[model samples]
Every structure is written in structure tokens, then in C-alpha cells.
Target chain A: MRTLVGNHGWATIAAPGNTGNVADFLVCRLIGSIFICFSAILSGCHAPLSANNSSRVEITYWRTLTGAAGEGQEELVRRFNNSQNEIHVHCEFQGSYSDLAAKLFTAAAAGAGPDVTQLGTFEILQFARAGLLVDLKPYFAGPEAINTKDWPGTISTAGEVEDGLYWLPFNVTVPVLYYNEDAFNAAGLLGPPTTWDDFYLYARKLTVRDDNGVVREAGVALWNITWPLISAIWSEGGKLTTRDYGHITLDDPVVLKVMTEFQTLVREGAALLPDEASGGHRAAFKNGRAAMILDSPAAFQEIFAQAIGFTPMVAAYPAGKNGKVYAPGGGGLVLWAKNPATNRAAAWRFLRFMLSAESLAYYSQQTGYAAFTESAQQVMTNDLKDSRFGVIHDGLRFVRGDFSINMSPSVRNAFDEAFQKIMVDLADVKTTLMEADAKAEHAIAERGI
Target chain B: MTRTSLKACGIRRRPRCIASQWRSNRSEWLTFGAFVAPNLVLFVTFTYWPIVYSLHLSFLEWDLIEPSAVWAGLGNYARILNNPQVWRVASNTLIYAASVVIVAQFLAFFLALLLNLKLRGQTIFRTLAFTPYIATTAAAALVWVLLLDSKLGPFSFIFARLGVEGPQWLARSGLALVAIILVGIWREIAFATVFFVAGLQGLPPECYEAAALDGATRRTMLWRLTVPLMSPVIFFLNVSGFIAAIKMFDIVAIMTKGGPVYPASSTYVYHLYKLAFRDFEAGAASAFAVLFLMVILVATIAQFRAGQKWVHYE
Candidate 1:
């Protein structure tokens, strides 16, 4: 039998009196193969660079849009890539606004994240305060700088915090009223309601009941979110909070009055409050179960595309007592402050491309978000003339985001809970609002807001 | 003579005995170490390290975006305890957990007994019962949402036919929690049924034969022999079911998002997630996590201690 023996550091099969040449050969070959494999892996790990693009700066951009909007964003990046070979941007679609914010925060804490990301209006102040955002004002001074005069004043200044412009408007949207024209014609309404009283009366008229008294079609479907409701509250001469968020006034008498009217509509079976599981109010309107809905223009494409057998029309939100004061809704671009100087410059260049008139117009037309720039509106002149698109853009001039208390998640949660209790549970409006105010104050103090 | 006597008497032979033992068991010890090393390393890295770090974080205030944290000590715990929402959320969690566990186990045990009977299409029944446990929870939840719609759902059609308005299962606060509990029971019954069936099949026939020979009734045999023999499975199902129900997050996240009002149907993990991610309060979330861990630990220990009375080892 052959015995195994150790010589120096090698194990070998030892014959009676022979040197283990085969074992040595096998061991040497194994080590050689491992070395070659490791070398190949290391060499293959380098980023693929083409001959002409060796000097191009690579940067990452995280956006929070999907479907047609996502495709529009991708097309813009593609055009920018083809326009010049100086930079290459890798655009990634992060999930919804809240999801993106959560990931961005954790990533920023680790000193690593995308070079640029889309930020919601509510998140701008928080991020800027935390020093995670780069001030865009510094980048707005060069030859390629954006001309703020062309952008709507409210949209342009929405990201201003502590005198620094940390976010640049990209996909801006304003809430608009979508009504089923067929239902409106059947209800014998001459035109869209111009006042809240007309809106209430119109809802009652449009509501269709069967012989059994079950509502076959609701008159209006209220979106169960707080965004569109903000416009209603503001139009009624009610403020959610002060400009500085020093005090929350959700319990204001005017706010209660507006909410009570809404509650009355629901109680009267003229309005539908569809839950998210039921496809929200949008689906209710699309399926001919509801005649009208208040939603952002961002929902226009999908609503029109899916509202079969009904002529979905766009109209301005019904004016409240103080006339319409709309709240701007949508997201903007924010550069990460921790990016290297070279990457930051490349990211800014990409962001500038994204905000160009041509790109903005293309995105707005594709996604139903309003083109916030004059040049972009000029680009879409024909489209803007259409009644459906015209009504959506009309609210741009009246948009306001001064009520920033909704920026606090705590306060927002309180408002949402209070709204749900009033609408769904039919709780006492005054008591619920009072409780929400107390909750918001407690949260504000606890968070040192 | 003295040295030899001492060595043979086990006084001076202790070192040699240990050496011999080590030498003989060296390969066995190495094999055991090799087998356990990977799991140990993984547990330390993913579980232990995070738990220890969370404990450290609970003592400090951090928003998770800032570079440094402020020392808050027990302030987070104190604030969490004082927050009324915490009590509301805790009550919701307790209600959900207790309802899911007791109802699910009761139904699952009966299902297991029914399925264990020698009926036609037994294989098909088993597969049907187990399908929900294997379905992707998020996808299943979305489908459930559509099925529970107040106006357009099948239930609404059925209710309309009966001349009654369908209850808004997911819109009303109280009914929303009930709907969640029903879904939890539906999902959990599959898991518990499969285990119970297996345990039933594994039970010894000798005990039942002995019971019959002793002139015991079928009911007596079932209650005494079968149940006693199946106590371990029952114990396991209750313990695991309670833990899973308490930690439920995905269903609530997809179905209601703790809605219709704050803390209406929120569970512990869902509330903890909102605190950490939504509110950006890492310290308070960590404190919440620590408290949650303690509650789960105490509950599990209590279950185990009570189980010792009835759980039989074969």
C-alpha cells in the first residue's frame, strides 16, 4: 500500500523509495489555475469603456416615476447622452416619493447615494435643513444657467429654504377637476360648476338612483388623499398652518365649514369616498360610477386612457369663497451634496438638460404634468389651446405652497387621520379637528419643529 | 510504588486522560466546528450585531440623515411610554394577535381532522388548503382588496340581491380590523393545517388499539390518546402562530396602512416602521424595537413554561 507522507509543507503519496513527482506536479497545477482564475476575474471587473467615451464622466440619477413618465425621463437622458459625449447618466427609477425619500435618507447617512435624485415638495425643507442637498443657486450663474424669469414664480420659489434654492422644479402638477361629459350632459348642467354651492348642487343632480334607492352612479368621488383637499381648504380662505409652520390651524372655523360641507355631501349619498383598495376615487370616476373627481393633472393621461364609454373632460376646480388658490403638487430635482465635484458638475449638467424647454414640454405632454416654464408652454402652444389641457394649465398662475405645515409628516398624519374620521366614520367634526390640533402641537414640540 | 499508585489512582493521570480524550475526539470536534461555523458567523453578523447596535442606538437621538447623534439616554423610552398613540397601537396589536392565534388554531385543528379522514379527493383538498400559504402575500393582499370593495365587489352584488347594502369592510374602522383578522386567519390556517395533518399521520396506532381494547369509547380515545399524543404539535403551532401574528406588517401595509384613523389597525412592526422611516426618528424606533423584542421574549417564555405542563416528548 502507498502511504501518505508530509514533506516540508506538501502532502504526497509516498511509494517505497520514490520521490512524489506526480503529486508535486498536481499541486503546482492547481495553484497555477487558481492564480489565473483570480487574475481573469480582477481584470473583468473594470467598467466597460468604449474607445471614444473613455474621458466621459459617469453619474447616477434616481427618479421616482414609472410607466410613460419613466419612459419620458429615460428618453431625455438618452438625448442628453447623444447630444455630446462628455457625460453619461445612468437613470434609475426609484419607487414612489415616500419610498425614494426613505432610501435617500439612509443612503445619505452612509455617505453614499445617487449623485442626484427627485425630491417631493414636502421633503425639500427637511433635506435642505439636514444639509444633504446642494444649493442650485450657485450653479445658476454660468452661461448654461437657467433663467428663473421664464419659470412660474411660485414653482420657481417652492424649493427656496433659508434663502437657498436647493431644488429645481422638474415635473410640476396642479390639481384640476375631471368630469364625465356624458354624465354632465345627462344632468343638464350648462358648464362645470364655478362655485362650491354649484358643485354641491351639481353633485346632487348628477347622482343617479335605482328603483331600490341604491346609488347607481355617484355625483362626485373625492380623492382620499390630502393633496387635492389642500386646494379646497385654501380656496375656502382657510390655512392649514402659518407660513413658518409655527402654529397648525387645521381647526380653523373656515376649514371646519369646508369639511362639513364635504361630509354633508357624503351623508347625502351624492359623493363617493373610495378607498385605495377600490382603486381610489380615480377608478370610481373612470368606471362611470362617479361623474366628477378632483385630482392632479398628472392623472390626466391615465384617466383619459382608461375612462371607456365616457368623455372625460378637464375643468378648473370649483372656486371657493375666496376664489381658487391652488396648491402646486409634484416633484423636483435635488443634487446630493456629498457627490464629488466632478460628479456634481456632471449631475448639474444632466439636471439642466432635464429642465430644458424641449425636454420639459415632452415630459409634460407624455405625463400630464404641467409645463412650468414659459418656453415649454410656448413649445406646447397647440396642445395648450385644447380645452382639456388649457383648463389644467390655467391654475398654474394661482398656485401657492406657502402653507408649509403639511411638510411635517406628524402634522400631515394628524390631518389625514382627522379627514378619514370625518369622512368615513362620520365622527364629530369639531371634536376630531380639536384632537388633531392637539396631536399636531404635541408632535411639533416633540420633534422640535 | 507511591508514584505508580498515585498515577493509577486517577490523581496524576488527569492530564493524560484529557490528552487521550482530545486526541481521540479531534476529528469529531473539527467536523462539528466546520458544520456550525457558517451559521454562527451568519447569526453574529446579521442578527446579533444589529440587535447590539440597535440597543446602542436606543440611547441616542438620531434622524438617520445626520452625521452625529445626540445622547438621549432613557428619554426615548420615556417619551414612547407617554405617547397615547403607542397605547392605542399596542392595544390594536394585542387584539389582532390574540384573535388571529385563537381563531386560526381552532379552525386549523378541525380542518386537519377533517382532511385526515379517508375521503375522496384527499390530495386535491390538501393542495387547496395549502395554496394560500405559498401564495405571494402582497399579490394575494391586492386581490383581497379588490374582492373587499364595497361597491363593485361580489359581496356587494350578493348584498344588493338581498336588498341590503354591503358593509364597507375596509372603510369603517372596527370592520377594517376584522377584515384584517379574517385575512390573517385565512393565510394562517393553511400553514397550521399542513403541520397538524402531518402530526396526525405520524401518531402511533398502538395507543389507539390499546384504548379500544380497554373498552374506551371513540370520543374518549380521541380526547385522551390522540390529543395527548398531538400536544407537541399544538404547542408548536400556537407559539409560532402567535409570534407571526404579532409581527404582521405586509398585510396591514397593503390593505389599510393603519387607516380610517391613526392606530385603527396598526400592529407593532407597522408602527415601528412608520416611526423610523416616515418620522425619521431612528432613536425612538430603536427603543420601540427593544421594547417589542422584550414583549415577544416574555410572551414566548410564558408560552414555553405553560407548554411544559401538557407538551409530551416521545
Candidate 2:
């Protein structure tokens, strides 16, 4: 008369009348295992215990910063906590950018998301559209609002969605060209390449090959992601998407020219894409396998650390046919709508504290990111004395952020795939762009954008 | 007057007996509920509810952030079908799954046969063979990528020594899929070998002795006697291996990322992931999941039916 199916399922069912058998033992073990699993899950789901002094407002802040940047964020929180008795902020590092986004979305669905999060600038629009973000307009109108005049227009405006600011630009990154000064000296070059034509000439002159025609040292390496590629496109006077964000303009001939120039480097063995196994393209440059690399200025400290034998030089992105536009890159802090009213206000207070002049200066100095506010710039210039930060801050005016769209993730993926096809598979450039353009259009339409 | 009194007493006593029985039944039911409640609650909360909710989601248009889902009926399904990428991913998945099953089973059986022999360090060999199965997939993929790297990898150096140029394993289109498949096989063969070893030990020695008396060669014995006797294990491996292959994600994600172009190495799960998380099309992803579930279900049932014909049991 046993009603339960044991560990072996049908075997336990068939031996129903046997009261003391192996099936009974197995059934007990199975139940024990299930309970163990349940305990583990429950333990994971337990909320972080609060400090019991309940008068102070408590709010959770999740961020994707890691390494030195992560430590800087923790320092900021420590400073803010020390400065105030009204709010208690709990800062947690939540892995990488994509990892944080997934957690945030899942938490938002359960209405247990953090009071604040640092997300990519483009994501502000997507989250705002989904109503997961607080508009912050009311805060702007309030007395304690963040000063818009102190912030860089590039940083401030990039966080806007439909005229409503959804995020406060915290740390900013602008793409820059990092070159080996020793390699340039050996190659008899005076300075870093300033234009596309100069880039090709330097790349050819700096490239060195072995007896087997294997490239011993490549002139440059381009990251496979969209930022470097977009920088190249904009430098060539091409736009990925039109002004209204309604359609893509990648199929234009200017983009074709940019693609061809990039491909020629790989084809001629002067430059290459990052090999997935050997870390990244920047790794090659740091290890002296490549003469130059294009990467974010935020990587300045890391590249310098790994540059061991050579002096790492930071310069503006190599200009192309039309002008010297760089890619605007960085993440920003956004308040979550899932937070309680008091916690949301606390989060707002924390954001302002993080963006203050001294705080921004400390953050930028520690993390190698650019200071976004005028006051922050003055502090960096006077206190930090890092001239490289000033160069990046000036480059911000000429850069444009990745086109803001609610469906930007899909668009970015489409472009990544197309870039891979051209660089790795050696597919026809024009055909791949056409295909990617169509694919992005379809994604946008399907997303109801 | 005495008979009437006795009948009334009997009727009252019967009613009391019935009430006592009801109370005993209630206590028994309570005990049963207490025993089953932990599992029942967990099953409904995690497993059963999510399945039912996901099914409901397949018919609606909802991004997880949206307050309410819009009724889309069969629109999500239509979009999945209309998009040409689904078919491409499906075809790649089929190739990957079939190849993994065939290659992994062959390698596992051969290794198990070798390990079954009377050799020194037998335990060490078995442990070494089973290690990769228990290893973290992300770490293993990273190691594999390093091993296959062209410029600085040992494999490339070995190839160069042999006067052969190594292909860019993660860069080239056709080779990238091959690289992923090789890693997939590496991860699976260990598990299959462990199962095969156990199955080989379970075979009765009498059969082998009888086959030897009949003057059968070792090869003949393995083919005629061992394989048929081990058919059930082989069949189990085939079925489970195919399911694992179809659901493969981490290795591809960590290694190739469905890359080098469209229709190259993207699997069904990877495509569905892009839809759900990256694109925020939960409805379409749900529809895709429903289709994926049906596929695995049908394939599993078919394998069982096919097993009945070919699988041998004593």
C-alpha cells in the first residue's frame, strides 16, 4: 500500500508490499537529499541581515565595477556612510556588465531589485521605457538636485530618455589609441599616427616577420567589439544608425571604405583581431607582440602595468578621412523604481554624493576614468596631477555615445556577429553589412520599437 | 419490552464505532500530509509552477520589465518560424548533437574496453578518464582554447614540428564548430566511460568462458557476445548523450559564442538566450522554449521506442 515512488521510480513501485527493503532505504536517502537542496536554496534566498539600529534608512546599491574600479566604488560608499547619519548604503559588486543586467531584470520582476544600480548609459532608455527606472525629473526640480552646469554636456545628455534624465553620469570612458613608444622609436617614427593613412604607414613599417613569414610583431590589433569599430566608422564620416534612430545607415559606401581599410591590415599581416585564447588584442600589445592597440582610456593603468618593458603612450583615436571623432563609452548610476520612497530618496542622496567634485576626483584618479564635472576637473588638475586624464576629458567633446535605443542590445549583437564574419571568416564586407542591417531592422521591429 | 431495549442499545453502539473509525482515518491522513508536504511545496513552487507559467507566457508579449503582458495569441510562434535564423540554428544543433552522440560513444566504449583489461595503475587510469566529466565547463573551455591557440599554444608548436600548419581553431568558420565539437566530446566521453566500465563489470564471466570454449577469438567475443550483452548501457548512453548535446550552452558560450557568422555554430538554446535576455523578447523566447521542449520530448520517446528493438537485457 506504499503511495510514494522511491529513488529508482518504477522499481520501488513494483516492490510495494516489501516494508523493509532496499527501496525504503533509497527513498529515505532521496528525501534527505531533496531537503538538503531545499536548505541550500533557502539559505541563498535569505536577505542580508540589517544592523538592528532601525532608525537609519537602509538601501542596497549594486554595481558591476571590478578590480581597482570596484575598490574605488567601495571607498566612495565608505566615505558617504561616514559623511551621513540619515542613510546607510550597502554597496555590492555584482560581477560583469551583462551579469548585473540579468540580475537587475530578474530582481525587478520579483520587486526586490536594489535601490540603485550602475548600468551602461544606453540601458537607461531601455529600463526607462520598461518603467523600471525613476525619471529623476522631480529630483532635478528639487533643491538638492545635481548641478547640470557642473557636468559635461556629453556625460549629462547621454543619460537622457525622452527629455527625462534617468541616470547620473558617474565614471566616463573615451576610446583612445595606446602605442608602444619604444616600437615607434625602433621603427624610426616621430609620433603616434594621427590619421588613417598615417596609421597604415606606421602599421606597415612597424610590422616584423619571421623566416616562415609568420608575423613576429604585429603593428596594431583591433578589439572585436563595436566601440573600436564605431570609432573607425565615425572617423570615416559614416553613421551606423540615422539621426532619428529609425533605420541603420551601415550599408553606405563610407562604411565599406572603413571596412576595407581595417581588413587590409589583417590581410597584409600588419595587424590582427584579438585571439580569444591569448587573452585579448590589448594583451598582445602589452606583451610586446603588437606595436599599438585601440582601447578605452580606462585601461590605461592596466596596460601600463603589463607594458613591463616599454612605455605605454596614450593618444587620441587615430583620425580618419573626415575628422577626429572618438567613441563615447562609460556606465552611469540609475535609481530603481522598485525601491521604497525613503530608500529611493536615500539612493538619490548617494548618487549626488558619488558625483560630488572631490568624490569624482578620487574616483577618476583611482580608476583611470575621466572626471565629468568642471569642479571634478579642477580637482584632478590640481590634486591628482595626471595629465593623461586631462587628454581624455578634452576628447569627450568630439565623441558620441553608442546610439541610444531601447533595443540596443540586439543591435549590438548583430553588429558583433557581422564584425566577426568580416574579420574571422573573411566574408564579403558589403554582403555582411547588408545582412546585418536587415537583421537589426527585423530585431527592432520584433521588439516593437 | 426487553427486545425493544436491546435493539435501541445496538443502534447507539454502532454509531459510536463509526465515529471512532472516522477519527482514526483523519489522523492517518494528517501523518501522510506531514510526510509529503516538504516535497509537494517545493515541486509546485519551483518546478511545476514555472513550467505552467512559461507555457502561459508563450502566448503573450511581455518583457520582464513591463507591468502587464499583452495578448499576442500565436504571434510569437509565427515570428520564431518566420525568422530564418531559427532553421539555421536548428540544423546546426542537429549536426552537433548527432556527431557528439556517435563520436563520444565510440571513444568511450574503446576507452572502457582498454581500462577493463588487467593492467597496473588501473584505478589511476579510471580516475583520470573520469576527471573531465566532473570539471567546470567554463574552465575546461578556457583550457581547450589555450591548447588550440595558434601562435603560443603547444598544439600549434606540435603541428609546426610535424610540418603542418594549424588552422585558427576559434577564428575560422568550419574549424570553430569542429573545435567546439571536440571540446564537447572531451567533456562527455569521461561520463560514458565510467558507465561503460560499470556495465562491463556486471557481465557474467560464465558467458566469456563459454565463448572461449567455442574457440571464438577475442575480437569475435567482443563483437558477438560483449556488445549485445552491453546494448542496454550503450542505448542508455546514446539517449542521454543526445539530450546533453542538444542542450549544450556553456562551452559554446565561453568558446565560440555562436560566432564567425550566422548559420555557423549557433545552437537552439543560444539563439533563444539572445532573444530572451539580450533582446528582451520573453514571449518569443518562451515560444522557442516550448518548441525546444517538444523536440527533446519527441526525440527521447523515439529513442525509447527504438531501444525496445535493439537494446538487450538479461
| TM-score (all chains, Cα) for each model | 0.91, 0.88
Best by DockQ: 1
lDDT of 1 by residue, B12-121 (tens): 54546767876755544454554565578679989999999999989998887776789999999999999888998899899998988888888988899999999999
Residues A1-449, model 2: lDDT tens digits = 35554443655444635544444454566567777987888887664437556688888889987878899999999999999788888998888787788788788888878888898754666788878898888998898887878665455667667767787777788788899999999999999988888988899999988767767789998786767778777888887875345877667788777887777888888887765555778778888889999888678778877786999888877787778776677678899997677677788899889889989889888888888678988887764455566667777777664444323755666677777778777778899888888887886776634
**Native-to-model Cα distance after best TM-score fit, residue A289 in candidate 2, in Å:** 2.6
TM-score, chain B only, every model? 0.88, 0.89
Candidate 2: where are CA atoms >4 Å away? A1-49, A275-277, A382-387, A405-407, B1-25, B162-165
Question: Judged by lDDT, which candidate is best?
Answer: 1
- Residues B1-314 of candidate 2 have per-residue lDDT tens digits of 46579787774334357667656465444445556877788889999998888889999988778888899999999988987889989988998898888999899999999999989999999999999998999999999988988766898898777665466787677877888889988988999999999999999999999999999999999999999999999999999999999999898888877765655777989888877776667888999999999999999999999999989898
For model 2, what is the error of residue B202's alpha carbon versus the real structure, in angstroms, after optimal superposition?
1.6
Q: Which pairs clash inside model 2?
A: none
Alpha carbon deviation, residue A123, candidate 2 (Å): 2.1
Candidate 1 structure lDDT: 0.84
